[model samples]
Target: MHDATVIGNRLRTLRKWRGLTLVELAGMAGMSKTHLSDIERGLKALDRRSYVASLSTALRVSEADLVGGPHLTQDPVQAGPHSTVPQMRIALQTNTLTEPATDRAREVGILTAEVKQLEDVFARCDYVTLGSRLPGIIDELHFHAARPQNEAAQRDSLTALVEACMYATFRMKDLGYGDLAHQAATRAEEAARLLGDPVALGKAAYCRIQTMPREAGWDRKLTAARRAADTLQPHVRSAEGTAVLGMLILTSALAAAVAYRLDDARDGLAEARDLANYIDDDPCRNWSAFSITNVGAWGVALAVESGESGGAVLEKARIVDESLLLGRPSRRATFLADVGRGLAREQKTAKGALGWMLRAEGVAPQRIRNSPQVREAVAVMIQRSKVAASGRELRGLAARMGIPH
Candidate 1:
């Protein structure tokens, strides 16, 4: 995508050369001050067509000359008066840095936003460049927290800080920066506790899951997930609230299944199922599309974790097939795990469910691969695949990865 800032800088430079103030330029171009300033900054994501017309009109440069310049895209433009401001390239943000808000739905929004931004970075920014700013992000989160604001605004900023922390933590993990991620998650919990909201506390609890040993950890994670999931129950009269509660319960169920707490997982899933039914039946429900499918998706994961029973596999398949995950990466990961679990049941793959495991990995790298949701599947896949059979790659992946074995 073409950076508006560079084009804006070009326009600013040309106007200055003509000795035009923004006021003078606005008159010349028959545009407003805001419009002129907007054109000068790269905040706008203009395409080729808009680029030509706007730059030609505002910069007073010939379209041919504008197009001919080397600074046409997000690709680096040479340093000069008409160049782009260098955007910050930060290192992988650890998961802890990207904390969920003290509210349920906002966490989804923040994570979703980060996932989208990551896609852009992968497409345009150099991996090495984006990999250098982890420490700065952590610093910024605390700095932002210390600034003064009204109570409501302060809460909102805290939410943003938590989201940033979570992103940093995940980025740190994906880039193999465990110590940074661990530190960020630790800090995130402290911040979330300050907020004292169930949703935030839950996220704070789950954030530490990655730091603990597998057997001893999931239990605490499940406890935290359950508390968070159940936190919205008091407000569940509304269909949307019910759906949100379902999601929290669903999270707890996942942890329970991982910890081999089949009874607990079953209870949560059953409750989630009832909530999903109400959300579907109610017309006034304010649930988003993701909110609706979140529970069913969890059910599928839980089914797999619980070693899918006689009809549970088919039910999950049918349910997931009807899910909102038309092309969703997280959904695909869930589906892949379900498939892998099914395969495991039938002695389907001698290579140990390679298809599902590989697809989960494939679907995630561009989507939510670095997310907390994807790890359980990966752990199950690796363990089942027997990749740890004294292989060089297995030891390397386990030892190098900060994930508890």
Candidate 2:
């Protein structure tokens, strides 16, 4: 494993590069000087999204710059996903809506099927397979979308292109290519606008919201989500529309939670719950996976983001049907990881937190290993571990994360 890098070390380096004192940087970031000192000295974990956003904005760098990402590694299993990113970047950069970089493409029907298969791989959090397959599919879909044989073929190709770009947006963002993610999201939005389906447009809006700049204010994200949901309101008579709207509401809830607006966050969650009650099936499967089960998972995440205690988050988790989450491995892994993060906040429950994180890793090793939150949680547990057996387990996990133990 490569030597681990911590946010504190990066923060200190960036601060010095900018020639700013602790007091100056803290004032710029809207944090106390003492707090900034603690974060720089590695006495505190830079885990909160808001803090990361503020500091990145203050430092004039990306969130990934502070967090140290696109974590390249020697382990083949882990390195496979990162290797494909260069080709993915080239594909996105070279292709345009009017002209595809590649001339060869499969039939529209075959391309659609391939896109659907990739979607399933994405749900399973199989990043290696997804990354390897995405560039070709994206190029092919763009080709078909640009010059279709007929009107029906054009619509089908455009829809498939929208979905493919959505997947690309998510993959790029997860891999720490924020600019590529934004570019993909823009392509999705363009395709959706051409398709002119409200649900497709809603999905595109969600992708755009997800890829918003890390320094973007939480209020801006909340407003964008709410506005998108409202625009989709008249079309929610269908299950797909309802599910998409529900996802937008949940996004709003998360933004509000991060902004520390408890009442607004609860309102958004309540609205999403009502929408979830209307859909009996996973109508947004290829998109948001919006369902009652998904809603419950979002509730647990909301509780954690709102700074709830471990017991409170666990209480929320009890209502979620983990069995239902089996169909969506990424969601399952994220829910379990959120539970782990919540538990890790308290010293008394920190040891138990490792169990949930390990379960999440079992579900999605690539996702868990790449996650900044998971890395921070492991570091925290290592600091708090007192028992020899638990310490050994924590060290093993840290080693897997390439963190010094």
Tell me the deviation in Å of residue 395 in model 1. Answer: 19
lDDT of each: 0.48, 0.83
Off by over 4 Å in 2: 1-3, 15-38, 41-43, 58-61, 281-286
* Residue range with the least summed lDDT across 10 consecutive positions in model 2: 279-288
| Tens-digit lDDT string for candidate 1 (66-168) | 4322212121211121121111112223223244222122232343354335433432222333343323443444444454235664565456555455554
lDDT of 2 by residue, 184-229 (tens): 9998998999899998899999999999986788989999999999
CA error at residue 209 for candidate 2, angstroms: 0.8
Each candidate structure's TM-score, on Cα atoms with residue i matched to residue i, is 0.50, 0.93
| Residue runs of model 1 more than 4 Å from their true location after superposition | 1-138, 149-153, 169-182, 209-212, 215-217, 230-232, 235-244, 277-292, 309-315, 349-362, 366-405
Q: What does the lDDT come to for candidate 2?
A: 0.83
How well does candidate 1 score on lDDT at residue 105?
Answer: 26
Error of 1 at 369 (Å): 8.8
Clashing pairs in 2: none
